[model samples]
Target chain A: MPRILRIAGAQMGPNQRADSRPAILARMIALLDQAAEAGAKLVVFPELPFTTFFPRWLIEDQAELDSYFERAMPNPDVQPLFDRAREKGIGFYTGYAELTPEGKRFNSAITVGPDGAILGKYRKVHLPGSVEPRAGDRFQQLEKRYFEYGDLGFPAFRGPAAWHAPVLGMLVCNDRRWPEAWRCYGLQAMELMLIGYNSAAYDPNGGSTENEAIRTFHSTLAAQANAYMNATWAVSVAKAGNEDGSGLIGGSVIVDPNGVIAAEAKTLGDEVIVADADLDLCRQGQTKMFNFAAHRRPEQYRRIVDQVGAQPPGA
Target chain B: MPRILRIAGAQMGPNQRADSRPAILARMIALLDQAAEAGAKLVVFPELPFTTFFPRWLIEDQAELDSYFERAMPNPDVQPLFDRAREKGIGFYTGYAELTPEGKRFNSAITVGPDGAILGKYRKVHLPGSVEPRAGDRFQQLEKRYFEYGDLGFPAFRGPAAWHAPVLGMLVCNDRRWPEAWRCYGLQAMELMLIGYNSAAYDPNGGSTENEAIRTFHSTLAAQANAYMNATWAVSVAKAGNEDGSGLIGGSVIVDPNGVIAAEAKTLGDEVIVADADLDLCRQGQTKMFNFAAHRRPEQYRRIVDQVGAQPPGA
Candidate 1:
């Protein structure tokens, strides 16, 4: 029998503002226990899994802001959740707002080993929203005001498991809209892509109604493209529910190497979606039918770097 | 002074069944004349520029099909268009339905040099729609029945004027949706990418009204990503108008090396969009902001080739 990696997309409900760290930890521990019980080798949580997507509101005070962003990964309060996952022998992906030591901040994700050691860290690359307050009817998405641009580039690392297979990547909510994130990871030949998101129900521009199915389909389409193009398994999880009157749609999915949806969560609750994926499938897709490298021609793409406008200040 | 390529986007209108090759060729020649008048080095036309987007409707008769697909590129009829472009000292990119000698049919694009020589040919890689008939309300796009999947992989070629400077590459309509097309060409250092498309009005599946602007945005976004990621200039032209009552959206655009829309056509007629692109800008972008080659990790991508499925029979 071919060795299979049993991965789970842990789709959790909203982490309300009133929810404390211990309460969230208990909930996360329960999820890990459930995933472990279901024999999942890995479980992926959504972006800002511990709290609400706080960047939706604007903030000016420094003290109140520090409360939202974490100073360290395993700081005393969140240590138990890591310890529980290690105890459960299940690796996981979690997203958070990181307040760096250098006084800069970033929206980031962390992949932790079954032993609770940090496997890899990825900062969100494509930051959306305005840096300063805007004069518009659109809901204030202060991501740019809250977080600095990512300093950590695309980097994949080996996960701690019996197989010791390399599963390289990351994706925050909005990063899925951009192809560069997947391209960067695909160029790295990332076997497993972990993306977590907290997408709002209302389109700030008021384009389409908050259709949950469409959002889910959109997520699946992106996953399908990434899987087919890069020959990697893309697992995306979401935090869904009415968080302080704002709805976050949830349709967590696990896409196989062939761009097929192997398993997906149905309800908006704490659910673990598991699927057995053969690592060899990704290798097969890349080298055979969709062999991008073998048929690639880089010479014609030399114009991609040609600058159209004057270079920005400081080179 | 650095060498620059002045390319023109020949945004064409509808080409109905009753519309003869002479009529279409006349429009193309006019566009070439306009491009030449604008001092453009090359002009690009849309996919299957001579016929209605036939794949939108299913057809099975072999004899009826033979009338639509072209047996040759400059087959007596299209020769005049080429002759006119050559006479005007301008290169051109045009899409056509090809019937190969081996009995295989393909939706292909050809790059014609100023001297009327065929510079390069590309068969579209991504074949959209079903192979067999589907029982549904959706407008069945039967491309698989009409044209075989492309065998000629993405290949970039050196144009007449620039041998070592920039390699030119081609992609057809649906191929724009896939990043592999850009990446494949990017790897070869393709300096200029010419993509031609003819998108229909209906969503085929009857989901939502086809957003031509969004589709156009996708093209520009793809061009921008490819340009920023690979440091290449991409010019995408389209054939717009209701052909036999099927409305086609036209948003032809010329994107420079830094992913900026340099010039664009507003009308869905025989419009000529010209823009000057510098080759040195590509080198600068690659060496600076979008330096994927220098910072990219290939070691992790070893699994990309190791995972292909078994080759299809008779390979």
Candidate 2:
């Protein structure tokens, strides 16, 4: 019999600006209670689960931006929910904006064990948008102004509660768009990948509605390719629904090691998508046809990291 | 002195159902005339330049599908465009749906030399969507139903006009999504990559609008990465406009060997984007820090082609 690990992708509704931390925590606790009742060993939340997508609008003031980031994981406001999850013996993944003491901000995620202890923390690597204003008319996505590139490279850790079933990696929204994130974790032999995202509607300068399907399919295809390539079960959860008139389309999903969509959420609302993943299946996948480890030709790829526009020694 | 190729990306507007092949061919000829006037040695047209995106609707009849595909290039209608280009001594890249003599269909592109002879032919390798019906409320993307998986791998050929330039490669719409296409061509020392696409608005079922910016950015980033990594010039052209109520966004662009946007089309309409690509600059990029040829690891990847699932050994 395969050792089945039941994981729940908790797709939350939009986090309105008016919503308080206590209210969001109450909702998260309710979700944990529900997942615990459903017999889920782990529950994953979307990126920045506690707040609205702050990168969409441009904000200049430092103190104004600081208010959006959490200084500590379970500061006084979020301890009860973490305490409750520990009592229920369920490991969970959560995403938020983090503000370090050195005056730097990072989009980060944390994995909490059933015992209420933190298993590991991961900061997002690929920072989207730019600090300077763009020349075009599209909505300015000012992520570079808000968050710094993560210091942490892609590292998979062995969690205490996840020992029986090794679950190793995590990513935030924009990080999923790049294959390197999954490739890095795959190189580490990560068995399970938990990724969360918070997306907004309205084309930032509003081009055409065309390529929407391709855009979404890009993610699903990435998940499929990454899962099959890495031989790891990938669970991607999203925070859907309109926040401050910016609608977020929810296509939260759970893919098996073979890249099959086992379960997926339907709408931009609060919902739970569960999938029973067999860790052995990933081992089987890695050993079989979809193996990237066997077919990659690094001998021919020596120029991948070479910097362009570098000056010559004498020049 | 650098051997600079003046390449032009001919961004096209909508191709309506009522637009006859002759009418479309006339427009293409006009674009070619304009490109020739501008002294552009090479011109690239969008994917499926003759017709509107037929993949949007799920069709089953063979005759209807055949109608969407081109039976013969330069067959009566498009011959004028080719004749004009040949007369003008201009090499061009154009994409179309191909219906073979055996009745198999494929998304393909062809590069024609100044003498009107075919320089290279490429079929899209990455086929998106389901082979059969999808079983839910999800919007059906029927690419697998319409075209067969590509047989021809990434093959680069020498251009007619540029005697000193290196080999050039071609890729179609969906093929642009995968890095394997670029890597395959890169391994062959392709100094230039030409890609054509006709992408629809965000899929109403699979993706939301929140990912628009990243999706657009991915297009440029992919080109930039490929150009930088392979020491090549990459040009991507798009067919933009609302056709049959479906919108296609256009941001056709040109990226140099250094991964900078040398030129870009103004988002919407029939426009021409031009850039000067120097073979010597690409050679310089290849020799620099991002040189993939000098730094690859083949010993570690030994499992990429091992067959998974239930395939019988050598059966």
Candidate 3:
């Protein structure tokens, strides 16, 4: 029963577009009271982390793009970081910009738990940029002209028996470089994933083929190879610096299911880090090198869902 | 007009179950004349690169496991390393142990082409170990008691118009740590991949939780995050050290398409490692952050082809 947990991450640092909403919920309730004073019990935080990465703008006012979404999640501008993470019993995970009551828009995320409920939610299935607006780009990703794609899919849940309930999952922020949204939460054996990002430390298409240290080494090598090919225990985080002139890219990590990097983020801002994790080190890659029912084949996967694009052989 | 190519990887090192077959095709025609004197127009080579990783022992002799398969693939003892890689016009990729004239058995690989033909053939569909035989362990992965799984699926080919024909694909050695076999050859827009492995530098189920420098950093972090989430240009290679007594792992990379490490292998023995690549740097990740039709969703990847294992939430 070596479940362990502890977690943390936080990272953040840029909420500029005239930051407010009580200053980004007081820097996310001070990074959830410095990750519940370092004993952690979850935490995460990043992908929209409440604004200033508002899809790098092209808003064209619809009340300034519905004032960067969230028509309800904990409503009162995020009920004081969910009433200070349910008064510090902790458990978090973030990302936002939702909307919906028949209005639709996505790029979501969730996770909550230590009694504040919401365990797992996702939505943000690999959206990267454009839906118009790139002509002369001075920062503009527009998340496909303002959200929609993620119709809630890569699910996976549980995580409550005080973190021992580990399965958990959640992506957002370019769905951490899509390995089919971490093999659909690693076919549900998911033992803690929770990502979040802001990315674009350059190369948001106004290209020079990526910069900002190779897009922070492609965002920590896509969270250390999709958390070592789904043996789980990831973290991701990041919101990073220079938002009022777009930049982002912090390299916040955590990783390990042997993807290594146990705690990273040598600062791009609010910081926090931490680690502990263990979840039985994802049982030696889910019982010896990812025993997806003894190495999955899914009938050699139907071109991963009968093709979505890229056909180039004779094309 | 900047397609560039020049690849290479060779790698090799241990063949010893009393080596010979013209001394392993004269060490694969001396690593294909040292990757055609380093001008290398593609080379790769590893998975069962002709003998000695005989599924690490447990063989009960059927003519000694049909003397390690390959009944026809330039047979006649690998025809002088495919006539010296078609007399150095170069172009390669390897792996072996096939058999098929209906008697079945796979774990293959191919590729050939600098005019010598072949151009593509893959088999090893993520076949790893065991088909029974664990109990007293003294090394025995038995590749599921002698191959089969790869009924030819992750195809993707082309590569000829003097290398600019790119596309290509192929994976062996635990199907390069399966991202659904690199998203089924990155949905076929492939642009170069070609792997080959031998893995295990310890922990081939004797478990001490991996070693040989974290199994050569999980075999170059699964070829640099599946060649940066399939914006292609890979390589992989490696057969590496100590055979008859186990141990394997040796870096052997090449990567690119933003996964970076363009050429590695600081030896585990016979090396080669070159690079060049630049197939238009896979068009900045297939037109902006892996544009699998402006970012894949495939009905939220139906739990990666409707589940094969790990259904853990309350199960």
Candidate 4:
């Protein structure tokens, strides 16, 4: 059995802060329909796809920050998109801001089956930015202050049977750049990785030489290499273009186990890129080159678990 | 002060099994002279540069295999190349098979400083190949049968003051593809990474869809992405072209902390690729995006140390 699945990436343009809720949901539903029309069984959407990338600004009011978070998933505001996906018989992986009843917030993502059942959930573990806002900066990255570090570890689960029951994993934005997170899922034999990112066109932290091209290159480089290392198919979608006066990069890609780009987004807009991923293409790497049982030396990897920071050698 | 150190990759052409030791050393000394004339402070050479890739052959004769291993550092057989490097005031990194005093064998490498003093040593940790040879195969990868797994973990050291005394680490061949090996050095705040490889143009193991171009792409991809993720400058050289009737890849590269290629080898023969590596260029990534203290969650990465193989989710 080839175990082939047609997957889609819904790369969206900027969702301005002034954009209404209904307008954003409409765009998402349209993307889902486009993917379904292309015969895609699963579509991946970008992080914080429902609204503007709010972390670029510092929110002073509690109500304003809370408004961006979904107190409960599938709540009335976002039900239409879910209903549309179900009607089209298409599954989706999407990111959002989550708020628990106890009031804790997290940068989160979930995989919903074609029948509108949630298959898996993941919170962003590698959160970038700072808790304290930098003074004298026009745009601030306050992800550290807005959301708590994800407590749900990298977990791998099986997709619905129609999708070959593939072992699936999820990552959001910056989390895709961390190899440790990928390694955890790899140990679980994850066959497909879904990622959603809202990366800045410039250095998210002020005062660096990184530009839109370099940032986009970094995002793509991370996705390709991590996918190759883990021997899995990957779909990394982006929420890109100028959002809320800050520029976000857009180079969404669907990469194979060999790190080759199968299909890529040409513009930072509402685009649907599709690729027929042969899940078995992962076997060559998984069984030979990336055979963890034959190659991995965990005893020599103590530094990865024992330390959290770089500790340079003495003077 | 800008700590700019000019580095060169001494990518060697093939050394046929019938080639003489003096002939191989002469080629290496010529490369050393070329790098020194170009004002390079440090030069990196490929793994087992002194001999043909012996792992490709199944050597049943113990004496023949013993001839390939170096019994002592700076032995009489390889002194002229070291002398030439010292004469030019150039430091270098090179790999060689080792036959220790206790008769243990290992695939190993060393970094020699400008003054002819050894700065650091590392054994290849992720050795790729099987202990048992596949029956009816023309080429055999018997590294597992010939050498023990490297006991010395990834160790980071510093260069001489003339080379800015920058923190440096070494990984031989396949170790470069394993992110865990890089992370160990990254935890030590490694500034520059040196690598040497003799990867095949085709899958050394029989029966796969891989080819020369894809293998070369994989080699470069690993170097670029690992260098970027670890926020270090890297030089990965190759002993390329056909050796002992088997083909080898030659995409040796010099990569910056941003994962951009500074220089790359254009041929499969003797090539010298140079790059002016700014040590300060690593600061931005180390201080921001890759600041392990701020972003890494080791508590959730226990799987990396606790297991060596993939254990897929239950039935």
TM-score of each: 0.58, 0.55, 0.39, 0.99
Candidate 1 vs candidate 4: the DockQ winner is: 4
The C-alpha RMSD in Å for every predicted model, in order, reads 12.0, 13.3, 17.5, 1.1
Docking class of 2: incorrect
Better of 2 and 4 by DockQ: 4
Fnat per model, in the order given?
Answer: 0.02, 0.00, 0.90, 0.85
Clashes of each: 38, 46, 1, 0
**Worst 10-residue lDDT window, candidate 1 chain A:** A306-315
For candidate 4 chain A, which ten residues in a row score worst on lDDT? A202-211
> Candidate 2: misplaced stretches above 4 Å?
A134-139, A161-163, A209-214, A290-293, A308-315, B1-315
Arrange candidates by lDDT, descending: 4, 3, 1, 2
Ranking by TM-score: 4, 1, 2, 3
DockQ order, best first, reads 4, 3, 1, 2
Output the number of the lDDT-best candidate.
4
Tens-digit lDDT string for candidate 4 (B1-315): 899999999999999999998999999999999999999999999999999989988899999999999999889999998899999999999999999999999999999999999999999889898999889899988888888999999889999999998999999999999999999999999999999999999855565688999999999999999999999999999999988878899999999999999999999999999999999999988999999999999999999999899988774
Write one digit per residue (lDDT tens) for candidate 1, span A121-220: 9888667666777666445677878887666766767665463475558878777644556756666667888999987755654646336564565566
- In model 4, the clashing pairs are none
Best by DockQ: 4
For candidate 3, the docking band is acceptable
lDDT tens digits, residues A1-315, model 2? 566788888989988888887888788888888888888888999898887887877777878777788899978767887888889899899998998888778999998887887877888876666687677644566777787777676667765635354757888876775455666666666788899987554354665432334345445655655665567898898888877656665778898775668888887778888877777777765663334343343333333223212222112
Better of 2 and 4 by lDDT: 4
Candidate scoring better on lDDT of 2 and 3: 3
